[model samples]
Target: MTEKPVLDSRAKVIIAACEMIGENPASTLSVRTVAARAGVSMGSLRHHFPTQRALRDAVLRTIYDVATSDDEVIYDRSVAPRERLVHCLRQILAPQVGDEARRAWTTVFDAFIATEPTDETRAAYLTMAAEGTRRMEHWLTVLDEEGALVPGDVRQHANFLNAVVNGVSIERALPTETSVLERETATLYQAVDAVLRAVDQ
Candidate 1:
């Protein structure tokens, strides 16, 4: 006899949260709703994530995982270093997200901003942002060690790059005409190229 498939509580909650974000970000996400959507008991959800902050952090991490999977493809050492860097920058600017996915992420961001300030949510969000910046710094350090980066402060370079990326993301969320979209899209490549030229020897 075949055994029943075992579901992971954490994964179930993350998936359910993602779905809810897309469906109705304006609505408060409750434990009951997430548990029901995941087909798991509230106890099961809490077993994995003891608090709502923990659950939100998990959801954000899952989103980052999905966004950055293309990093694997660009990590091939056989490729030229400059080419790889360009590819990585492009990937960061243009995450492989469809229209619906884009809207879902925007919705989450909107709700997060609109909600009254809370210590837990703010802390979780700041931690994620810091981690992302650290990842950028790590990449820059790698390039520096490879003798690709110009002799300068790697941390500062990473900060600049991170800021540009964040700007691009904010631009993407705003509604715009096709002509504006075309101009801003070109700026993505230009920004990447400028940063690389400044850093690359």
Candidate 2:
């Protein structure tokens, strides 16, 4: 496939809108604000995304892309599965996990879910999520064949791991009793390990 453009004109407007929304989560993201920030005319913005929902959907798709994209740098892959898993855990448990990044990223998603979302939005997000699940399943299948995983249906095992990772990430993102960065990730860590062990056994 050809390389993706840095950002299409429509995408630029959507990103600008997202930035505005980020400034104040409660602010209603209107097309005029986005057009000004994108340096595009309202007509131009509308040319690409004819309606408000169309623009919103575009922004949400961008969010899903950013969230699931292989943006993280993992230089070392020489380690065993368990050790590699630990590295992945640390990557996810980093301070930024539940920080502004998470909140800002989830804000649009929360809005999308507030009322009944369109079939398009659900498809976009769910497809992205399924991509993550597929990756997890691939990793687990490889490890299991290498005798790194405990045993059983590697696909199901991977799905379970995916569930734990997603749930913990969501929980950490909430306005919890304590901060995820300062407090220990021990409980969540143990919970993940236990689930993995169950898959092995």
Candidate 3:
């Protein structure tokens, strides 16, 4: 029997959208551009996503899956708990895991702030935030189960870590003297170290 293909045309379009966002987050995303990038026709893109909102939501969902997928984490029991925790947290900051989720976030936020924020747009923001929180909480829960977490609320710790990591991204967004990549990498390591120190009993 023949095996099935991994990504269908619709999925290809979605991936193209993500790559486009990564390439130029501020560019106005048009179906024609995305379809061309995916090597599909505009009709094919519309068949998959009838509206721009649907296409954007699909990209967000894909990003969430990429960032939160368990496969991203190393499951080696031999690795120390703190080491594993840092590795898992670093996945959130790396784009290779999903083309730098920060860019996708910036694109979404730009859309929200650049235009009149509507209830629907606000809802999308909340949905993405919840997904991120849930992913962070999962990693923290794993650490807590392994007895690596200190005496504190796991949810709060997750939120704190998320806040700090996002702060790094925010600061990097502004014009600065230092190289953004250098600053981002250094800040990511420091943030992870700080979180592990606080959480490791």
Clash pairs, candidate 2, are 150-200
Best by TM-score: 1
Angstrom error of the Cα, residue 185, model 3: value is 6.5
Clashing pairs in 3: 95-100
lDDT, residue 28, model 3:
47
How would you order the candidates by lDDT, starting with the best? 3, 1, 2
- Model 1 Cα shift for residue 166 (angstroms): 2.2
Error of 2 at 46 (Å): 18
What are the lDDT scores of the predictions, listed in order? 0.66, 0.61, 0.69
Q: Number of backbone collisions per candidate, in order? A: 0, 1, 1
lDDT tens digits by residue: candidate 1, 1-201: 999877688778888987774476443457788999999999999998898767766776665556565665445667655666655666665652346446746665765686775665566556567656766776667777776665678777778778877776666666656675566557655654554544441
- Cα RMSD of all models vs. native, in order, equals 4.4, 7.1, 5.7
Better of 1 and 2 by lDDT: 1
lDDT of candidate 3 at residue 161, scale 0 to 100: 80
Candidate 1, 160: how far from true, in Å? 2.1
lDDT per residue (tens digit) for residues 1-201 in model 2: 899768778768977976864575434557788898998899999999898767766665565445444423222346545555544555444434557647745765665667576665565455545656655665565556656566577667667776776666676667777555434455445644653554332
Better of 1 and 3 by lDDT: 3
Give lDDT: candidate 3, residue 174: 50
